[model samples]
Target: MKIFNTQTKRKEEFVPLEGKRVKMYVCGPTVYGDAHLGHARAAVAFDLIRRFLEHEGFHVSFVQNFTDVDDKIINKATEEKTSIGEVARRYALSYLQDMVALHVRRADFYPLATETLPVMQDVIQKLIAKGHAYVGDRGDVYFDTESFPAYGKLSKRPKQEMESLGAQDKGLSEKKNLKDFALWKTRETKNEVGWDSPWGYGRPGWHIECSAMNLHYLGESIDIHGGGQDLIFPHHENEVAQCEALTGKPFAKYWLHNGFVNINHAKMSKSLGNFFTIRELLKQFTGDQLRLFLLTSQYRKPIEFSLDILREKLPLNQRIEAALEYLERNLQVAGLTPTLLYNEAYRGDYGFAATSTTDETEATAEENTRKSLVASREKFLQALRDDLNTPMALAELMNLVKIIQAWNKPPEVKSPSPSIVTIKFTFIILREILDIFGLYPRDSGNLHPAVTHLEKFIDAKLQERTQARKKKDFKKSDAIREELNKIGVEIQDFPNKSTWNWRK
Candidate 1:
């Protein structure tokens, strides 16, 4: 597998330091508000990477950190007249809930800044001992940018250029250089939350929190370190300096950063009044549809999010679900037992070796269909391996869907249908690929109670309309159809049955 390394500015082959064991660290949110579309994008982007690696037979240990104590969290606590812990707890839970809703797997270790204070302090002391950091006049510790010769290597900015960015915090006058960033910030107000450290009562700076947690959890070096593209500068740059200065080893083998999510061609931000929370979006789009929409673009490419794009995804998601459902229902009607040919235990294998069939021999048409399915599977995996080109992979999946749809259609008169083994194997491959993308069939078993009730209500109305048609009462049937349409329901009539779906 090849990944674009931000530090090298090129795509390179991925080779874990420990063979077949990958250690990855992604920056998590600072729990001050609800998780938004940006957060969802970041989560899903890394989740795809992790899932793909695992599917390739790698043992991945993923770690993400929560900045539970920050200026934002403290300010939110003061504004809401609540404790810092309460504000952090509420939003942290909200972020996790959003991740679950988006089908993002939980990190193996979710260390919090508050819990890693000792670790952060130890890193600061090491930097100070190495003359890479110094204590400021007001008891705050600032990293001495000049002491580290490769300070701007990761960001690729000259020291003078970086100094012009300026500091927003007050300890700038105390720092030896303007480019220097705080390792431990001194609290100005007694009411704010803080912890006792050598640099007085204060909290860890945003950059140091990640560096400390990653070093403590994943050792001195990691396989991959990732976050949004915005963090490439000061944030990740400082992290690299801090870790390498202390351990004198490469911080990470590969640096991956996902692109931003824009709204109306502008960066999504609260200041723009165009920011959207994940919860707000969930009300309109199902989790699977949202996931598919996000994966429609390459991970490193910026995506312009809009309602129209989401609406387009809804029908695509519906088609995939319908195809899978049809495959299952048709297999049952044909009196053929549908077997799951793919198993988790054989994920490392390639081609038909990953799937098994009871019938070894097949007819000419069935063999042709099987070859097509195998080629599609290979194309899908190749796309993912090429730096996580999800758009290409998704196109392959859609192609498979088209092939299945064509195969499921009734054969010509006197023509023999494909073998049951071929049909079952194709279903297995489709489901396995979809599972990697976190798309699952929405069935009654997992439907929300309110939705189930709504579906039952709609079914009853359709049944009533059917009864009206059976009685030859055309007026009653027309009245029932009009009433249903008035409430945003569209019913389709067939010779023997009727179906209803919601109309936007």
Candidate 2:
């Protein structure tokens, strides 16, 4: 598989450091407020990479940390007149809830900054002892930028440029070097949120939390380290310096960063005042709908957001959902068992579980369908393998849906052949691919409450309309049709019967 490494600025082959075991660490939310689209985008992007890794037969130990101790969290606590722990726990739980709603798998470890204090302090001690960091005059410990000759390598910015920028900012005036960043920020009193360290009472700096967590959880070196592109500069670069400085090894084999989410031609951020909370969008759209819309663009490119575009993508998601329901319902009616595996259970190449005769020997229709199914699955995997090109992968999924819809088009045939069973199982394999994408339909059967209710109402109305037509009450029949139309229902008439579906 290939992944675009932000540090190298190129697509590179992914080979885990420890055989087939992959250790992936992603920067998670700060947990000061509710998660927005920006958070969801990064979460979904890395989740896709994690899922793909698992699908490729890798044991992925993914850790996404929560920055439970931050200036924002502290400020929020002061504003709410509550403890920092309360504030952190509130938003952290909110973030986990949003992840669940979005179908993002929970990370193997969700270490909090407050809980990882010991490790953070230990890392800082090593840096200070090795002369890579020093205590500032004000009691804060700042990293010694001059000590690490490769300080700017990951960010590709010259020390001169960083020095120039730091000169303008009043915050760096106290540090020995302009590029020096805090390893620990001292608190004035014991009442504040801090721990007793060798350098006095202070909290871990923003970047140090990740470095400490990565070291404690995944060891000194890991396969992949990922976050949003915004963190590429000081955040990730500093992590590289601290981690490699302490362990004298590569921090991570590959660095991955996802692109931003734009709103009104500007990046959507919590500080920007143009962000939409994931909770707000969930009111009108399902988690899968939101997820599908986010994946419409490639992970490394920004996606423009608007309700119109989101609604337009609704049918694409619905098409996939409708196909699954149609195939499952039809197969069950034909007394055929639809065997499928969950996303985690899928080990790749399990899609062809149902044996079939030679394609040339099968009927022409079945032969063509089987070829399309096999081709679509291959295309889907190929797209994902190519740097996780989700748009291309989604197109392949749509093609699978089209093939299923075409084969099952009706005048409902009930004489289930072995070919049909093979096609159904193949479709289930395609569904496994969707699961890897984290797009699972809520109802794969005919038991969706809203859908079942609508069916009963529509069926009753259709019956009433039929009686009206038989009684020569043409006006009443027309009125009934108009009523259904107002409710976004359309009916297609046939010689023996009629069928109904939501109007496009």
Candidate 3:
């Protein structure tokens, strides 16, 4: 397997430090605010990576960290007149809820920065002994970027260019280099939250916490390290520098970056004054819809998330979902052999031809067109291998679903040999792939939440109208419909049955 490593700016074979075992460390959310759409993209991107790796039969251990201690947490805590841990804990819990709702698998470890201070200090001590960092007069410690010649390699920026950019010295001793970053700041009342350290009482820097957690949890080298592209510059780069400088080993074998879910061609950031939290957005749309929309584009490309597209794209998904559900329902009703797993042998390689034949003899070749199944399956796998090319994989999956629809539908067709092993092979493969992509299993196998609530309200309205009609009031039925219409629900009358779709 190969992945595009940001450090090399090219695709490289993915060989884990341990044979057949993949370890991934994702830079997790800061936990100061509700996770936004950008956060959603990163999470989904890495989630796909883990899913695909597991699909390919590799054991994966994924760990993501929580930055419980930060300026934002402190400020939010102060504003709410609560403890900092309370603020962090509330938001962290919310993030976990949101992640679970989105079907994101729980990581092997989710460490908090505050919980790993001792490990962080140990790493800091190594840097100090190596002369890569030093204690300042004010008792703060700073990483001397000049000490690491490869400091800016990951970001492809020159030291001269960085200095020319006029970055702040950030309140360190005069003896410290201007470009040096703080490892710890001297304890002071002004710095709301401080932890006791060798130099003084201070918390971990944003970048250091991840390195410490990554090394402690996954060790010096791992299979993959992923996060939003925004962290490429100082955060990931510094993590590379600090971890490698201490351990004398590559921090991560493959560095994966998820492109931004851009707004107006600009990266979404708090400083940019344009941030959309995923938790809040999920309130408006289902998690499946959000995951599908995010996966509609390749993970490496930027996504222009717009309201109109979201509206348009969702129903398209609904249509495909509706079609797949139709197949699943009919398949179950037909009582086809309930097999343990789908088997894929003797299936056609791929394409529409695999599922079609104009000649009677060819049609009676005793097959479900092995070629078509192979083609579709190959395309799906290729897309997955190509940096988890979800959109392409999605297109192929939908196409396969259509083919299945065409074959399994009305026209009395010749059934293939029931004993053919490949017949079930194709079926199981598609189902398995779809499951990993989070596009299968249809509605909750019950009424949707929106539908359930709408039904309850409609039932009440119908009872009210039934009473009104008993009193010979035609106006009341029409009035009830109007009331439902105002709240985004619609009713359609049928000869024997009634149903509803969302109202505009």
Candidate 4:
């Protein structure tokens, strides 16, 4: 597998430091507010990478940290008149809830900044002892950027350029150099959140928390370190300097950064007043639809956020779902159970098609379809392996759906055959591929309470229509169907039974 490494500015082969075991870390959210679409984008992008790695038979130990005690968290706590811990916990839970709704797999470890304070202090003391950091008169400690000769290597910016940009910022007058960043900030007020450290009562700097946690959790060196592209300059660069300065080893083998999300041709931000939260988007689109929209483009390409784009991609999800449902219905009609097909497909024992001693044309078509299935499966896997090209992978998935839908349209078939078995195999392949992208919906067999109630209500109405028709009450039955139609329920009648679905 190959992935684009931000540090090298090229796609490189991915070989984990430890064979067959991958250590991946992605910068998670600072729990100060609801997670916006930008957060979701980062979360989903890494989630895809993690899932793909696991699917390729790698043991992936993923860690995504929560910045639970940051300036934003402290400010939010003060504004809400609550403790920082309370504010952090509230939003942390909210963020996890959103991740669950989006079907993002939880990381192996979610270390919080507050929980990793001691680790941060240990790293800071080492930096200071090695003369890479110094304590200010006011009990603050700043990293000595000049001490690390390779400071600007990760970001590829000259020291002078970074110094010029850092000089314009306020509140760093005590630093020896403009490019120096804080390792610990001494508490200036009683109300500020802090912890007791060798530098006095202070807190870890924003950049130090990640460096400390990454070391404590995944060791001094890891396979991959990733975050949004915006963090490449100061955040990730500082992390690299601190880790490499302390361990004298490469911080990570590969650096991956996802692209930004834009709204109205501008980057989406809370301050911009155009940000949309994950919860808000979920109200309008299913989790699968949202995942599909996010994966429509390459992971490192910026995506434009708009309802129009979402609407266009939603039918893709619906089409996949409808195809799966059609497969199930056909299986039932042919007296073939999903379990039987599942077992056969799992064993790679799809029975051969009927002999063509009486008809050669039908045999030829079956052979062609079998070949098509094998080709589609190979293409789908190849697309994912090629830097996780989800757009191309998704196209292969749609092709499989078309093949299944075409096979399902028939006059009548009394019994199941190898042809039906082929359809089931195709269905299983598509389902597995969709799952790797985290696009599969939870089984509807476990319905929400509201949906369960609605289903019962609709069943009652259908029962009433059935009773009226049995009694030859044509007028009442027609009235009942008309009422259901008015409420956006479309019913289809069969010789033996009836089914209904929501129209809109």
Candidate 5:
């Protein structure tokens, strides 16, 4: 696998520092507010990378941190007449819930800034001992940027530009250059939340929180460090200075940063009043559709968010779900059994191998279709390997859907079987690939408990309505349909059966 390292500005072969065991750290939210579309974009992008690595048989230990102690959290607590910890806990849980809605697997560890205070202080003491940091007049520890020669290596900006950018932070004019960032800030107000430190009572700076968490959890070095592209500047650059100065080792082997998410051609930000929270979008669209829309663009490219473009993904998701449903409903015809471990022994293969019962004669008879399926699978993996080109991978997924859809053009008609084994293998490959992409059949058994119960109720009501109509009770049938419609389910009636779906 190859990754585009932001620090190196080139795609390089990925080799973990500790063989097959991968240690990855991603910068998490500050937890002062709800997670917006931009937050969802970064979360989904890294989730894709993590899922693909696991698919390739690597044991990945992923850690994402929550900055629970910050100026924003303090202010929010004060404004709400609550404790700082309360504010942090509320939003931290909110972020986790939003991630669950998006199907993002929880990180192996989620270190918090408040919990890692001792580690941050230890890092600060080492920096001061090494003469890389100094205490200011008002008892704040500032990282001496001038003391580190390779300070701007990660961001690769000139010293003057770095100084100019740092000036925007309103730096203290005591004992250091403008580029020198705070490792330990001194609190000015007694009402603000802070902890007692060697340099007075204050909280950890934004950048130091990450460095300290990484150093304390993942050790002195890690395989990959990632975040949004916006953090490539002063945040990540300062982290490099702090970690390498303290440990004298490379902090991470690869730096991967995802791009921004724009809303209707404008950057999505709270200041601009254009940001949409994940909670709001979930009310109108399914999580799978939202995830697919986020992956429509490559991870490194900016994606435009608009209702029109988002609506286009619904049909794509529907097509994929429909294909898998067809495959499952016709498994008996293809002489296949239902089992997820069709190729459990093929652990490292691209796609799971076909089941043992696949007929060799039928496979030989359907050579052309089988070859097409194999080629599509190869291309799909190739796209993911080449810097996680999800757009191309999704295109290949659609190709598989097209082939399956072609077998039944009119939707109600079943054409001649290409090959029973071919059909079986295609279904296996499609389901496995979808799992790799984190997409699953919504109507399958993966529904939430509440949703599952609701679906069962709907099915029971439909069966009752069918019986009523069979007995020529038109009034009872109409009443059941109205009841279902009141709960946001639309019923479609055919001569022999009725189908229902959530009303769009």
Candidate 6:
């Protein structure tokens, strides 16, 4: 598998650092607010990466951190007359709920900034002892950016150039240089929650939490580290300096950053009044449709979200939804005996793999058509290997849908014979492929407990009407049916029993 390594600034074949046990870390949502569509893109993009790696038989340990302690979370807490922990807890849960709604699997471990205070402090003290960090005049710890050579290697921006040119936080005091950011910040107000550190009672800086958390969890050299590209500056750059200067180990093997998410080509921000939360957008599209729209663009490029484009994404989602409903319904109603393990006759070795951990081998003539389908899969996966090219991957899915639509409806479609296995693999294999894409069928007939209750109520009323009719109580039977019809549930009294269906 090829993965784009940000450290090398190119797409390279992915060889796991520790022999196929991929240790991946992604920067997760800040707990101050609800997750947005931009968050959805990053979350799902990495989710796809994890899903595909596991599909290829790799044991991947994906870790994502929750920045629960930050200026934003503290500020939000103050605004709501609540504790910072409350602010963090409330939205962290909300973010997880939104992720579940969007079909993003939970990370293997979710480390929080507040919970890792000791870890952060340990890292800060090490940096201080190493002469790479120092206590500022007013009880704050700052990283000495000038002390670390190759400081700008990741960002390619010289620290000297950014000295005065760099910016500092509001009310945040200047360190020795503007480029030197806070490793530990003092709590100015009494209400703010902070820890008693060697410098003072304060909290860790924004960048330091990730550096400390990652160092504690994934160790110095991690297989992958990812976040939005906008964070490449003071945030990620400082993290590199803080860790490398302390541990003297490569901070991360690969640095993967996602591009911006614009709203109709306009930048989305709270200041601009254009930011929409993921929960808010959920009202607009189903989880699957939103995933499709988010993946339509490559992660390295900006995604411009607009209603007009979103409307276009619906048709693609509809196809998946239609198929999902069909598959689930068939599973429910079709009582076919389960088949035993057998070698598939499909030839191309493309599409969805048939059930069985059989060895991948040459496909037959029928498998050949499936192999043609493999072209699309190969192209799709190549796009991913090349820096997670989601747009290219989506294009492949579009091509697959086209093939499914154009497929010849044989009288009775069956698995291909051994000689023809490759030819017949497309349909089945594509389902599995799409499933990894999080676009496979979902049970459409599922309803709330209330809907089931309503159905049962209608059924009871229908039964009563059927019994009345059987007794020749014409008036009672008519009244009973009329009562059910008023509630928009239609009943058909068949010879065997009373049948009911929801009103269209």
Q: Which portions of model 6 miss their true places by more than 4 Å?
A: 170-174, 323-368, 408-424, 443-504
lDDT per residue as tens, model 1, 131-218: 9999988888989988888999987987677887735566433778888999988887666688888878887788999999999999
Candidate lDDT (C-alpha), each: 0.82, 0.83, 0.75, 0.82, 0.84, 0.73
* Candidate 2 lDDT, 268-354, residue by residue in tens: 999989999897787678888889999999999999998898999999988888788777766677776655333333434444443
Kindly report which residue stretches of model 4 are placed more than 4 angstroms away from their true locations once superposed: 332-363, 410-418, 442-504
Q: How high is the lDDT of residue 212 in model 4?
A: 92
Candidate 5 per-residue lDDT, tens place, 1-504, comes to: 899999899999988998789999999998888889899999999999999898877889999999898777878878866777877786787688778778889999999989999989999999999999999988888999888999999989888998887777554437478888889888887666888898888877899999998998899999999999989998999999999999899998899999988976777876687988886787787778888899999999999998888997789998998887777667766565636434552532424344433567764546667678878888888899999999999999999988888785664675546655566677777877787788865633332346558789999999999999999999999999999977657899999999998543
Q: TM per model?
A: 0.83, 0.83, 0.80, 0.83, 0.84, 0.78
lDDT agreement of model 1 with the native: 0.82
Backbone clashes in model 5, listed as residue pairs: none
Models ranked on lDDT:
5, 2, 1, 4, 3, 6
The digit string of per-residue lDDT tens for model 4 on 1-504 reads 889888889889889999999999999898888889889889999999998898788999999999998877888788866778877776787688678777789999999999999999999999999999999767789999889999988889887889987686455328789998889988876556888888788788999999999999999999999999989989999999999999899999999998888988888877687898886787777667777899988888899998887898878887788788877776777788865665565433344433432357766666677678778877877888887788898898889877776655664732223455556666667666777889765432222244457779989999898888888898998898999876557888886667897541
lDDT of 3 at 320: 61
Query: Which one is best on TM-score?
Result: 5
On TM-score, the stronger of 1 and 6 is: 1
Q: What is candidate 6's CA lDDT for residue 416?
A: 28
After superposing candidate 1 on the true structure, give the runs of residues whose Cα lies further than 4 Å from its correct spot: 171-173, 330-345, 348-362, 410-416, 443-504
Q: How high is the lDDT of residue 120 in model 1?
A: 94
Which has the higher lDDT value, candidate number 1 or candidate number 3? Answer: 1
Query: How big is the positional error of residue 223 in model 6, measured in Å on the Cα after superposition?
Result: 1.1
- Local error of candidate 6 at residue 502 (angstroms): 32
Candidate 5, after superposition: displacement of residue 209 in Å?
0.7
